[model samples]
Target: MHRILVVDDEEAIRKNIERLLSLEGYEVATAPNGQHGLVIARSMLPDIIITDINMPGMDGFAMLDAIRHHPELDRAIVIMLTAADERDSMRRGMRLGADDYLTKPFRREELLDAINSQLKKLARFNREKDNAVAKATALTEEKTREHFREQFAGSSFPASQFSGYTPDGSSGFGVSLPPESSSTQTLQATVMFADIRNFTTMAERLSAAELAALLGRYFELACRPVVAFGGTHLKMLGDGLLALFEEDAQPQEDALSHAQRALAASVGIQDAVGSFKQWVQEQYGQRGLPSFSVGIGLHSGEVTLSRLGGMDSPEVTALGDSVNIASRLQAAGKELGWLVVASIDTAQLAGECLRHGRQELVSLRGREKPVAACEVLGISAVPSLQQTHPPFKYDPASLQAAAVQNSEMTARAAKEALKESLWSLQSGSFQSMQQSFRGYQIIRKLGEGGMSDVYLAFSAAQKSEVVLKVLRTSLSNDAEMLRRFIQEYAVLANLTHHHVSRIYDQGFTDDYAYIAMEYLSGGTLKEEIRGRGTPGNSFTGSPAQVHGRVIDLLRQITSALNAIHKLGLVYRDLKPDNLMFRSEGGELVLVDFGIVKNVGEHTVGLMPERLVSTEHGQVIGTPYYVSPEQATGQEVTHRSDFYSLGVMLYEMLTGSRPYKGDSLNELLARHLHAEIPRLPPEHAIFQMLLDSLMAKQAIDRPADAMGIWRGLDILANKTGSLPKARID
Candidate 1:
């Protein structure tokens, strides 16, 4: 498979060498003499070279030297084939970089062995070349420290040149700098703070020496990504790192490059820490190295770069409102689950390549205002650079804006009604149920599932209405599930998206558990579909509009699903009944997370067990929507949701179940063996998506929920009108 080039003056010798090498399975090319061989070497860029030491019109020595000078051919293995046995000739060839010397009339085996050995040596060298590339990439941060010193030496900042250098001097920790004499002298710079989450626990678990060693290695890895983009590490706050960026000394380099580099640094640190955590887990059966996340905040403004303390221990630092706000923005990310939080200014300077991550708002401490921040997915600053960065796109504002607004009319009703009824018995026993029932008007039973009955209730405190779900007493014994349900309330509290139902409060009256949530005026999907059939659902106002509206609803659900999946979890139970259309906003909102599960690499075979308890060696989920693999107890993934969505889509369009069965056993068997229902003639794009989602093989499905969204986007734009409904 390797290419070899042979050169010699004698025609017989060249022919014989080519024939022998060809038999040895090398792709062989040859030149008549040393001069021609040099041309061949330059032209072919062969893996190995063989040439005579003494020859006419430029001997092998000249050819080898010329070949060595060609950058492309220099590393190729060269063997000197010669009639001259003189020590001087061998020395000259070897010095000219001939890899091996094979004298004339040598054994066929000797020639082949020499060729094989030299080829192997070349291979080994190539392997080291690859390893060296990886090592150099890993050393990017290490190299930046020296570069930082040089840049610092040239900068206008006088911190390093100041009089104070002693650790105990005025310039030390908790010290303040004097006010600037002139505002014009201050330079605008972007300050950034990147903190590794949960680092203290890692330190506590590790011995002091181990912790020091780990920190040294981690800092070395972390520091490179920062330096790669031209940011200097200002200081370390325990497990967190702070970096600042200003225009480089060279005016030719834009500040954008520095922002790009900072983004890259964050990515490098993530990769390094991830690999470290994986390594620790593999070697010690413990991922005790620390689970870390990064938050980056950048604000551009005037900042005084200075040095304080005594001459012997001066510390370099930057102090200003810009720097303080950037740090505060980084702190705000802790509450928002953001990895790389940056100010809008930073994002603008960072440019599109770095601006793909989602935006979030956080309420900072001691500040009346909330800061608008964005998370950076990867480094993609320059197009000319290798495009290895993964793309991340999330829009938090769009998601947040979609939530249903509290109508003034309903808001007034809720406040007035809650005060007289359930709000009074917060800490205690259910004294009078008849009084509670009479106090507020329960519009109707919104829904009743296995363990709870939902009712739309009006409150007097806010004078608004809310949905109240009262839990059944029979399920109170399942403490673990109850605890999970309580924990889910906290999770819901943190998520501010509109499609997700907001939990207002939770309480128990003696033997009953209840949760108050946002009231949606529309009925469940199941009720509307059953009452109105396919075209004229009771939920939808018209038949023609229903098809287009349902498609839009699916889009909303898919968007919410995208957000849910981004949190590193899967919503296992995505069924029609769980999706409710809020007629107030004309938006479909996801209501339940009772079956949601955190998914990761190790959760391959675990999801089906949680969703479907084994009843007589059978598992869970309505069999109609259960993926073929899940029916047989196979592992589920994000793709499993696609299958369920496909089933829901079919029902929405055709007013019938895709596959029906008399019992759980029959349903499970039919799901495993039956063909999916045929798509109706209407909505070709919808049919295409449904077919793809219901594909028998998981790999055949779209890679993720986003893929489905993208397809829908294209379809929506291509079709001028919304998809039409088909009715018999």
Candidate 2:
């Protein structure tokens, strides 16, 4: 019988493999980890061994080395179980004579096929061994050595002796000697450090092999832009990487050139990371794996480059204040919630090519005084190389041509066109106010925010007016902002409701990013409320007409909230400004979804409080309409929407919010401690319904939107205030 040994620190994985192999008629044995697997292998002399790369004691790499050197088990067929990102471990295993490997979460067919393939190779090797030995005896020692080298030349393992030190930090072999340095040189360079944010906390939820896979993929994606923008990748420092862009010595490239390349590389790296995260969500998001962010820092100065350590373990690295400053900048990025940050020197040297945010004075370690720094947005214009395929040779002539094409009007254009182009090119903002996004033409500016701007636009395809939400110029390259802006489309696209504003189209252009949505010309509820002056004094209609109109509006609002709740979404920022009336239909629609949250998703970074409060003392949502739980930094649910709705209803009827205070703190305190405002005795039923909706405790409120709507309908009927025409 063929005996196979399965080893993994995870009991479920070990047992699962053992069961699978047993079902295939092989005698299977299981071990908790690599160390235990070695003991079993020595006794059982298993025909095959399948081991995990990451274990508690001896990792798969260390154990494979041991097995290859052992007298009895040296010929055993070994298969490594690794995660997709653990390419380094897989390569090392190949060098140590492992026959095959399977990525984690493998299918039964894949696992079985890998095993059978290795078994077939073993059978072929056994048959050829005697003939190979006979032929070896006829050759010289040098010839035999050369033959062996040629046989395994395709293997990716480094040409170093295999060390048996356990990767899991267990007591095994002593430390190995460091690799020797071969050469060193001094040069001017811009250094950058990109570190994964909150990696330590995120690591707690992932398996070792899983984490290895994630990090490996992240490094691969992060390193591409570095090389693409002419930066040399130095080394990976655990959850981060070190890269340098050196000034060309022959042409005597200036400091500005190095800084520009480094900054551009940083932008590319940030974009690539964002794309990777989105790809992961599209591919493996259903598996409940967490997503993360990266922080990058850039600095330019003189640095020493050297080949460090022994010949067997050589590492090319940079050493100087530039490297130190770069690393500190990465840390500052994390602290300040910025994706990319750079020293003032780097920013100044980058010049017009890069856009930057407000400058700040930051204290760096090992420096006597605080240094000036700024947040880097990205390259101001489309790169010339972007239009070509790689071996992206930098051609100055091509860049000049492209620059002229971008900065000057077309040859067929009039003199006015040339003048307009000059004005736009000279202005700090890359695009004019009447810029076009995709097929939508900007008509006028509606409003602006810290991160983005809203514009009134006309969509030729839709043949209707649409709202274009464009990201601000300074934040165009921000990964987090771009992500949130994209997420708004994703959220709205999935939701098909009459009362929810629809997204017609969304995309990014060379100059800006934007989302086109259905336009509402009837103005916001805030404007309507303001137009009415004081609530009770503004209406001159009969009491029944006023009450019936109020009921109709409440029904529409509640029905919209119900539709949102059914999809497990909460409009955290529900307020008058977000409610708008359609021009053609006059139906109220939930307009802004900037802070919408998916129930149970624990996203990180700014605006995370929109979803649910993961930590104390962090609050989100508008103060006047915020729920009690939300004000206290507690988990919010659909009930929170009800509280906001109740506050809105109170304002609609009374012309003011139920709770009032001189400061935001006092307002929040009122929500938590203030008594419920009493209504007029004549309108007792409506007052009772309002009191129920505004209950302090979530448990005391109506169960859902449907329940509240039904309750309000019944109240309207009882009071003979039901409208002749229902909005729904």
Candidate 3:
């Protein structure tokens, strides 16, 4: 319902106007004068304001001006009321931002018509506004997808390549690519390459943890500005970053060209690094660390965009002489003592004269000709731009000494690893019955499912151990299962997290569809629980030790689920058997997306689809661990997975499932109506989390996966089990 406020010195006039508008079903408020009216307007945020031109304490003109100044109230319609002969007063009110005017002794129809006309105008404006927002969003997404298609062309279903769509290309780069993904396209674009000026010396002096933290913080600071100015943060090359600004970028300021946007981003990066230098000095100044600074090089030219690497783990990066030129310029900046260097092509196309500290035709390696360039101090015309920092999904101080001993030069490695995997494969024909599932040698059958068999296989193509799942020969003709099997691969492709299983390749041969994924040999959480012998007090340790272990595992599990939930996808099946530890690292990884579903608005190429039919009381998950909502064949969501997490916690603390029965029907009924299982009296500190997670209603559960992760973090910190988390 729309609200209207009437202000006048005359009590009778105000009361009459209120009564009349109230009768029309409007929420009406009356004020004796402009001062009271302004108070009411701020409080109620009325849709329309009607005020007398003349008032004792603050006049209508003053009130209207005040309303216009309040961002929250400025959108409201204001109407002026004046005596019939006071034409000048009405004109003055109108000039002061009044929407309409009604003279005293006016007919009821005239007053109503004026209010209705203003409302119609406001409604029209809103419609146009909504349409414009949606159109702009659509255009931006299409532009990103167009670039993605250009980079990853020749795929049969090119649209499916990016279901994890982030306009800044965060997900599109350094994540999984489709099999047979060797495609490229050339386009005119502006590239900015940035690297630390004295990174090698810093690495030598600072401890490994110190260096990683510096790079992590620096990467966050630098990449944010590039994304802010409508540029693609394509890659974090060892101690350096490569970003692109295409001609098609939607300028935040319409007057700025793409080149100007790139230049502005370069300035923004330099400014950010300036601040970071101060932080480094404060952190390691006593150690006599070298001065901190960044050299940013900008160039504009034709560059090829492509997905480079193996089938399992592919990264999107720009390749061409232009990209190389930018890299060279960044290096050249070190010798010239320049902060930002721009090639003549970029400076000229930036749509404004750059503040050049020096200019020269410098000889560049690998090129016979010396290119004209300038040492850019700044761009006076470049306005203050809005920058954004990506989510802190990692703990920066968690960096260990191993990071320094054998880590990549781009030492944001931990945080970068948190932001998103490594997987490869070459194609080969099957030569023997035992060597089926092309390019992979099936080591042995690990387990059997109703529709498929899991095998520990070695991929000649990837040259790594992978878990190969091949559809059963009988179900080879089952189109639905085959589709779902492929769907599972599609779901895993977009999810690149350490706690989430990595997918390498997928193909159909020998009348069967198979997926090659990372091998987790540490076994399932179920096996760990079962190995503890009898049910009573399964975990054998001091209370603190047990609690510490439990918190550690839950934190890892929640982190995995957090990654899944953020993608707008749900891992519906969350049984203990489905969670396994990576062989290389002891970190738990969420596996088995056989029943995963895309259920949120931020969906990518994978639209909302019921992978399996849910008709006639069909339940999709294991009844023992399923949430009450899932047991009833109702809509499942990310929160539903939390319910399963609750069950897992109960079993880990105790030695048995939360709810048990002799038959399926009895078990499901218990899951629907059973009370939430409680932790033992000794472990009661964790009851709050368990109760909320196992609440019968999904709404009563923790709001999101990260909330639970943080809750566990708090528990760990309170008990002095784990260090306080670094991420905010």
Q: Which ten residues in a row have the lowest lDDT in candidate 2?
A: 166-175
For candidate 3, give the lDDT of residue 558: 84
lDDT of 3 at 507: 56
Give stretches of model 3 more than 4 Å off.
Answer: 1-433, 473-476, 533-538, 604-613, 723-728
Whichever of 1 and 3 has more lDDT, that candidate is 3
How many Å off is the CA of 634 in candidate 2? 1.0
In order of appearance, the predictions have TM-scores of 0.37, 0.43, 0.40
Location of the lowest summed lDDT over 10 successive residues in candidate 1:
398-407
Cα-based lDDT for every prediction: 0.57, 0.64, 0.67
Runs of candidate 2 exceeding 4 Å displacement: 1-431, 473-479, 533-540, 600-615, 681-683, 721-728
64-156: candidate 1 lDDT, tens digit per residue = 888789745666788887664577888887888878888777776688778766654543333333233223322332223333334333333
Q: Over the stretch 532-603, how does candidate 3's per-residue lDDT look in tens digits?
A: 644443256777877887888888888888887887877878988998977523777888887787777664
Candidate 1 differs from the real structure by a C-alpha RMSD in angstroms, to one decimal, of 27.6
lDDT, residue 163, model 3: 18
lDDT of 2 by residue, 610-682 (tens): 3322345446677788899988878788889888888887777666788976545678889988887776554
Ranking of all predicted structures according to lDDT, beginning with the best and ending with the worst:
3, 2, 1
Query: Per-residue lDDT for 63 in model 1?
Result: 85
